[model samples]
Target: MMILVTGGARSGKSRHAEALIGDSSQVSVYRYLANP
Candidate 1:
């Protein structure tokens, strides 16, 4: 599933994205996509 999140700078976008992920292993993978 694709979740598109839009917000201003320092709006907790990354933190929110991390929350959407399941756990630690999932985090590494998703963080890659989230940041890239």
Candidate 2:
């Protein structure tokens, strides 16, 4: 599963991603990248 969230800092990106994930056991690895 893959999700792409693009927004400014502290814009609920992580929160939304967590909600989308929602206790899913399949998603074993998680990664985050920041670009300026």
Candidate 3:
């Protein structure tokens, strides 16, 4: 399963995403992508 988090700046998307992943045991690996 995959979850995508998106929102305006400072919207806590990453924080919420981390919280979700932190509560899951099935997720063993994670990757972060960003544009430079």
Per-prediction TM-score: 0.55, 0.59, 0.69
RMSD of each: 4.9, 2.3, 1.6
Query: Model 3, 1-36: lDDT tens per residue?
Result: 888888887888878888888999895455566778
How much lDDT does candidate 1 score? Answer: 0.63
Best first by lDDT, ranked: 3, 2, 1
> Judged by lDDT against the true structure, how good is candidate 2?
0.74
lDDT of 3: 0.79
On the 0 to 100 scale, the lDDT of residue 22 in model 3 is 92
lDDT to native, each model: 0.63, 0.74, 0.79
Question: Roughly what TM-score does model 3 have, to 2 decimal places?
Answer: 0.69
Residue 15 Cα positional deviation in candidate 1, in Å, after optimal superposition: 0.2
Candidate rank order under TM-score: 3, 2, 1
Clashing pairs in 1: none
The candidate 1 region of ten consecutive residues with least summed lDDT is 26-35
Model 1, residue 4: what's the lDDT? 70
